[model samples]
Target: MTFKYDVIVVGAGHAGCEAACAAANLGSKTLLITMDMNKIAQMSCNPAIGGIAKGQIVREIDALGGNTGIVTDKTAIQFRMLNRSKGPAMWSPRAQSDREKFIHTWREIIENTDNLYLWQDSVKELVIKNNTVTGVLTNMDVQFSAKSVVITSGTFMNGLIHIGKTQLRGGRISEPASYGITEQLSELGITVGRMKTGTPVRIDGRSVHFELMAEQLGENDFHKFSYLDFEPRKLKQQSCWATYTNEEVHRILRQGLPDSPLFNGQIKSIGPRYCPSIETKIVTFPDKTEHQLFLEPEGETTREFYLNGFSSSLPLEIQLNALQKIPAFKDIQIYRPGYAIEYDYFDPTQLLHNLETKKIKNLFFAGQVNGTTGYEEAAGQGIIAGINAHINCHGGNPFILARNEAYIGVLIDDLVTKGVDEPYRMFTSRAEYRILLRQDDADMRLTEKSYNLGLASTQRHSLLIEKKEHINHLIEFAKNYSVKPQYINSGLEQLGTSPLKQGIKLIDLILRPQLSISKIAELIPALHKEIDKIKNRKDEIIEATEIRIKYEGYIDREKMIADKISRLENIRIKGKFDYNSIKQLSTEARQKLDKIDPETIAQAARIPGISPSDINILLVLSGR
Candidate 1:
């Protein structure tokens, strides 16, 4: 049978879920095809969402009307704000989720979304005509036609799983790997490569010695991923246990090195450098005697535990022996041994900033297929791809974020400008304008843009306006309110800050490193009254106000720098140049320019092989 739709999304993982939802929500007839309908938005690796720079990406996704953050909040088993001791920019919100619940929640959303249809099948090939995707042909001999296609085929594109000397043809354990799509794309002149990633073993919680390990509990606070005013986190909270692998464990791992697929010639693909296997860690950090590991709960009710920082592709015997050395895991009973999987990914440089391929019109690639390694990164790309696919089918300007604007911006630009040599993962240091991209203000940065595009709902925009009003009022009050020396001096001295010589504005007191608005509000009745006026999102408002007052100078400086660079971004240069004919440009610069075909002067400047002099030459040639 033949089916028709506006958009067809292959693979129903994190990226696919976001892509399908965004398109469907935007008034498109979207079909989400998956091999298993029950496993939509599956947490194939860790059961947690958001970490380090990843948390910021989740917030950005939420702000842009994506469902990841909302689903994450609803099913969270534990919530923790990472890097709390650091500055506000470094602070990120992470959550351990009920894995099964997460999948169910996403499936429910997919099934209920308007204009969205779900089909349980694997996409085998693309139906292309004259360098444009028409639809997809599934393995079931069903043909579905669409104006645009988004392939979020995560680790299932010709996936090969390895454990010790055994090799399996699967996307995940027991799940069959997909085929034909890669060969067809490769035949169409797209550059494809392989990358490997692994997950750790799942242990039966009853077998673990809880008394021997240090307990790590989640923070109890108003912090969450979504900016909408709601009581987040519905699941029961759980605690994670901290443990470490000692010299004995390393010795056992070393003994299994000969048979390990990662070390042996069985696995040839490049793995994520940041999240390496346990064997790789031992080999890389030989001088270090121990490594910390965490025993995290998979769900609120399930007794299954995920062993973080212990990923391996070693033989089952070796893995078991190594676990026996750790005190908390002396009686460890694992459901299955960890294994590594290698999958095919397209070179992201072959795609435009909007995630549409340069070779195939109306074709988009996202998630691991773009060589990104985290759930947050994939969702970030998915939302963009979905939005652009809708635009491609209908009529609208393509949505693209800048590097200084968001971590999502930085992630995509990094992918297309300088393609990955290893599996890419998001980190705080990767973003140059991180201070401006804080998790605290993702709504301020992205919500209005998505709202203007008719994706973010009216309720979300109203909430943003309300939050802004509260923040502005609070900031203005802090700036105007004066603190008398006698009233605040005692409190200031007790707090280890210097005593005030005279009256000062409350904003000045908040600028001090040791003082916070919450602490100062305790001393003054008027200030507390003003703060109390904000009934909903009180803590969030106060925190936003405090961050603005404290980091005002840094924020302004970064904005100035970003504004200056943004001028170069304004210069249109996509179809204006035949770079190979420009004799003044460096040979490598010409090749890179002709190959990647950058859209702006700033984007051209960001390409690795393009030097400063080459940029000057281009500016001169463009009549700058």
Candidate 2:
């Protein structure tokens, strides 16, 4: 059997979903091939999305005309703004979702989208002709023809799940692992490596002792991930609880180390460093007598609960023994044992910034295939691949985002430039300009670009412009309006802040840590009247304006640094440059530079082996 398409996207995971949406929405006839239709956009790990830097990426995806944010807003059972006490850059939005609803939402959107088709099958190999992907051959021996191909296989390629002494050939818990593709790609000169990641066991909520744990509730006023100003679907708000595992739990886990896959020679791959398993925590941090754990609800209807921090691959009995020791789980019953999965990933350096492979024209790799861990990282790359694939099919230049502009940009640059020694996860610390690439302003920064690519609609562009105008007007209003000392001195004194003896601009009052823009708007008549003009959108407007007022200096300084870096980025290096001829460059830098084939001087500087002196050598040698 054979079918034709403008673009063929393999895998229906988060990355694959976004990739298909992006391509199809851009007027390409796109086909989404997956192992199981029901598993499309499945959250195999935790039934939640967004946190810290990941939240910012979701906002970017929404701004770029993707569906992750909208689906999240429609299905979230609980929502929280993380790091609110910190700077605006660090304030990220996260939500607990209904897993079934998230998957269904994505599928409905894709199904209704024009120029998109879905096929349930596993791709066994690609049909390449003259150094370019023409299509793929599925396990059932069906051929799909395409001008461009995107593979976002996630963890299914030669995946192996470990549970103590037992090993299973599965991508997720019950989902079968994919085969043949890894072997085929290796023959095509794509280097492959292994990465390990795991999830904690799901527990029956009936077994949980909520009284023993500390309740963590969502805010009274809620927020959604989508930028469109509308009411989100209101699900019954749920609360998660935090608990701790004491020395007793640690002792039981340590006893099982002899049979542990992570500790023993059974599993050789490195797991995510930031989200280590319970066994790893016990072994690595011997001094700490306890570890914090969060009990997250899987869905409002189901009794299933996910243990947030107790990931393990110990023997089943040992896991039970350890959990029994924790006070909150004294009478707990495990629905399943935690397991670690190892899967194959290609070295992302072999790909261009648009995620298209350098070796194979019209072929792209995103998500876990690109060695990134989080759903956001995967979706970010997926969108880029989809956009680039569409451009390649119709004849246009590839779209790439600069690092200082968005967290998605930082993610792609880190992948294609630095590559991955381990599973890469995004953090606010990774971005140099987190202040500008904030969750609140993602649409302002990148929606226009996406609109040009035919991803974001005219309404999206208009919405973005209006939001910016409101924020700008609010900021100007605050700066221009002055508050009388007689009207504000009492309020200032009550806040324990120094009382003003003279009249001051409302913006000055906003600068005080003790007073916020909302409070100032309430205290001053003129400011309040001005704010009411955008009353329905006042909260967002005030938040955006306040951030600009609070961190104008730091944000400006970062911009200058970014501008200097952009100059280095503008210095292009030829694709086939001979680094070996530059004798002044270090041997390690020379070898690394030649391997990566960085397109810019700034990208060359980011490689682990490349140094400032080597960068200067490239600059002087290239006569930039």
Which candidate number maximizes TM-score? 1
lDDT over C-alpha atoms for residue 161 of model 2: 94
Off by over 4 Å in 2: none
Q: Model 1 residue 15 lDDT?
A: 96
- Candidate 1 lDDT over 1-624, as tens digits, reads 789999999999999999999999999999999999988999999999999999999999999999999999999999999999999999999999999999999999888999999999999999999999999999999999999999999999999988889899999999999999999999999999999999999999999999999999998789988877369567789999999999999999999999999887889999999998999999999998999999999999999999999998999999999999998899989999899999999999999999999999999999999999989999999999999999999998899999998999999999998889899999999998989999999999999999999899998898889889999998898889898998878888888999999998888888999888888888888989999898778898889989998999999999999999999999989999998999999999999999999999999999998999999998988899
Task: Tell me the tens digit of each residue's lDDT in model 2 across 503-575.
Answer: 8887888998888888776667787787788844568767888888988888899899999889999989957
lDDT of 1: 0.94
TM-score for each of the candidates: 0.98, 0.98
10 residues in a row with least lDDT, candidate 1 = 226-235
List the pairs of residues colliding in candidate 1: none
